[model samples]
Target: MLVLGIVLFALGLMFSIAWHELGHFLAARRFGVRVPEFMVGFGPTIFSRQRGETSFGIKAVPLGGYIRMIGMIPPAPGQRIGRSRRSGPFQGLIDDVRADSVKDFRPGDEDRQFWTRKPWQRIVVMFAGPFMNLILAAVLFLIVLVGFGIPTAQPVVQSVSKCVVPASQATTTTDCPPGAPPTPAAQAGFQAGDRIVSFDGRSYDSWEDMQLAIRASSGTVPVVVERPEPNGAARTLTLYPQLIETQLLDLDAARTSGEPRYVSGSFLGLSPIQPVTRQTPEQVAGYVGEMAQRAVTSILALPSKVPALFGAVFLGEQRDVNGPVSVVGVSVLGGEVLASNNAVASEIATMLQLLAAVNVSLFLLNLLPILPLDGGHILPALWEGAKKRIARLRGRPDPGPVDMAKLMPIAYGFAIVIMLYGGLVILADIVNPIKLNL
Candidate 1:
């Protein structure tokens, strides 16, 4: 089962890579850019087939993918293709990149080159890859939220606490401390599986409403619960339980600070059962929006986590559960999820959510505006367009497309950093994997 889960996740990852590259391929084709190859993964081609002018294929390494479009970098001003007189290390690197950019150049294919396209067209082609990932993430989130549902706390009682414990002294253990006061619900004979029908003489539709009512009330109150009988029948019972003031979470303050905040409220000591509940489209949209924001924040914090990642890999430090993970780590997590003794729907939903998160991460990471990223290409194109616009407004000669060849050295450097960081993450994943608490 573990191997099967890993294989399934690996296939999903490959499909996501292909989907991302497909966006670039389709957008490039739309703008008349000659894409000679559209392949998933990297390294030696494992399978390929020619379709029209494009050779679509899969490669040995399922790490990343790309679409090869002709003339990615414009030639140096007043210089012919494949010709460079500059003699320096950076110049040599730039020249090499320029040469590869036009390696597939053919007669009468000048207009089909990617650099010849308008700035907006070029931007569309480059941005399409990340946009596809965002779309996939949203769709997967919708499927999981609407189809499989999300775990929600219901009004049904899962357990009843024996004694009152203050919110500030919260602990995992349910054991009552010596001389602790007995909870109202326990005194009222509340049992697990009892569904709260009404509280304080008021019928509530949701757990939140019941909680608010409980907090607002004081002294002995009539609480109604529908308890199941031995004959599969349910009977309503009204029990007078004295509500006591205790510390409870302040949801509004917690939302602002992203940390627990507490205030005094009436305590009943009833723990709600969590059941899977389907959500509306609006709810799903809000959920995905929040997920995207968190993903962006995580990407921004990635650099700070590298030292800790190395510690986990080399110093035998504990791996942070919320820390960065590589593709290999995610696959292992999927395997653990599948091999666990969980319900089938729950496992499937968890896997889909994991894939959605991966897509969200891909969507944000590719938009970092660093060299070799989609945003890197996009920024230059926008600058070129702005320069042309400014030149026309000032009655000056139009500036040609930005010279991307000049940025090749920086791009190469960034690529190296990315590779090293990825390697470190992989090593950490292998040595000190973050296991699921389940």
Candidate 2:
């Protein structure tokens, strides 16, 4: 069942990627840019259909898509060296020639050239794919919030959760139910009914925030909180977060339809200070945005020496880095979260929410300044524009287009790194996949 869901969810995510690619495809077509092929997935084609000028196809591997824009980069491998041949045993003798052909070529017609377009136009065309993902995220969030209402459980004190206690009070306490509280987590002092408001500085909304902060802490954390007294008074507090073990529950299914079990974890044993419900679109967005911003700001503050974060790692001390995720990861997350304790309806909503989050993460990561990424390309374009402006001021000719010879090496190197990282992550995920216990 888990594998099935992953497969189906992956297909959905692929279509989402297809939608993103479609955004660029349609825009390019509209702008009269020649699009030779629009493919879903990479490697080899398994299915294809030609529509007007574009050949839309699905490759056997469900990875990512590519737009074969004329003159988008350089020429075909055979064309680069001016060789005329397709792959075959007979062509094996000319493998070197074919390889060099990728470098050759008659600089084709300018009409279909991507570089020929205005910078803004080119920027829009390039950004369209990621833009689609962002839009999809926003729309998904809006739908989840407006149509189904956000699935937020109250932070009310519950007997099932780990104990929440203030650091100062624990010294005088005599309760030792279950095994002694995790010292690391207890020393920092997290108590039930204390009301967790923020994580490492991010507003705490759902368990995701708490778990991320805890794991990021490498088992220790600096916590900020508001304690609501039974007498209607609120006192702000702080604590040292301790390392705690966690057992994840399948969140999606637990939303309702499946048996709900608790996932154990390192906890300050705290709940929201204030018990409030946000069921409206505006309320959900405003609150989720604020919480997400807090997480983002905390990450931004890493260099500023604020409470730093170090999440758990599977192997050694090193953290994992990889090329951007393909759809496979999202499905796995969706499946794992399904193990959570929740009603059926809530489970569905959580699944959607998780998917939105994955989309947002993917959307944002692509914007990092690296070659083959839109932002990376835009960086140089912006620099060239500045240079051109400066040259015009000095009454000199515009600086020539950037030297591809230099850029290609760096870009290809980065691409290789991405490929390698992606392979490793896939391998790690397979060996010890991230799983939740519901």
Candidate 3:
């Protein structure tokens, strides 16, 4: 099951990457740019087939993918194709970039260049890739939230404990330890499937509210539970719950693999009924919005988290599950989801949600206004458009497109920073994986 999950997840990520490239390929073609190669993954091509002008293929590495558009950067002034220029400290880098931009160039293809397109068209071409990822995320969220639904604990008794056990020592086993006293729920004849209607003669709505009422009580509390009878009638039992000073498990932390923490509180030893509830369209939209906001927050907090990630790996500190995860980490988590003892529906939902979150991350990360990223191209396009507008308003001659080659050095610097950070994250993921409970 773990192997199957990893394979499936890997395949899903490949498709997502391919889908992202397709957006760029189609949009570039739409704007008359010659896209020579549209490939998913980087490094040596594993399998490639030429269709019309473009060669489509997958590479060995599954980390990232791209669509190679012709003439992404404009040529240097008076610099001819296949001609060498005078070398400076950064001249080699500039010449290399320019050469690569027109590498697949053929005669009479000058008019089909990427830089020749309108600024708005260029922006659209660049933005389309990330936009595809966003669409996929929304679709996945819909399938999980509205189609399959989500489970939530309700204010109803699913099971009643036979005996009182320490919260830290509780397990699925029904064997009550020697000398363990019977719980208040068991002594009061509380059974499974009992709907907790009210506590102390007051009707309650949510399970959390009932939990608070139970914890606030000390001695005996008048609890009203509706139990279904064999004769198709419901009987209300007034159970005098002799509350005990027991340790209550922290429900929030119980969802993870960390040792459960216990707090001293009044106990009843009744478990809430968990039911799968379908969300409305509005609710699902809200969920998607919330996820988008969280993605933005995570992206913004990435710089702040670098020190902590380093500390966790080097200083032997606790790993933060909420910290960044690489492709390897995500694939491992996917395998864990399938290997877990959770229900089949739950596993499927979790995997789908994971894929959705990945897509969301891709969408948000690509929007950063740095070179090599889609947003980098977008910023230049917007700036060029603004300059053209301002020139026309002042009745000056057309300034033409902004020279994007000048930003290559800065782009290279940003690329190095990105690679370094990604390396650190990858190392952390391998050395100390963030093991999640769910």
Q: What is the TM-score ranking, best to worst?
A: 1, 3, 2
Residue range 1-438, candidate 2, lDDT tens digits: 456557657776787778878878877776777887899888888999988867899998886787766545433422433444666544443444233323322345456655555556666777787778777777777767776775355433332234544332344344655655544434555456555555555666676556556655643344555556656344434555544444343432332333443433445554433322336766756745653553344334323321111221244322222112335655786766555565666667767776676566556656667786766766665676678789999999866554333365566678887676566556545544545434
Ten-residue segment with the worst summed lDDT in candidate 3?
A: 249-258
Ranking by lDDT: 1, 3, 2
The TM-score obtained by model 1 is 0.83
lDDT measured at residue 259 in model 2 versus the true structure, 0 to 100: 40
Instruction: Estimate the Cα RMSD of every predicted model relative to the unseen true structure.
Output: 4.6, 10.8, 5.5
- Which 10 consecutive residues of model 2 have the lowest summed lDDT? 304-313
Error of 2 at 418 (Å): 0.8
Task: Quote the lDDT for 438 in model 2.
Answer: 43
What's the residue-level lDDT of 438 in candidate 1? 60
Residues 300-381 of candidate 1: C-alpha lDDT, one tens digit per residue: 6687788789899999998877788899999989888888899998999998899999999998899889889999999999
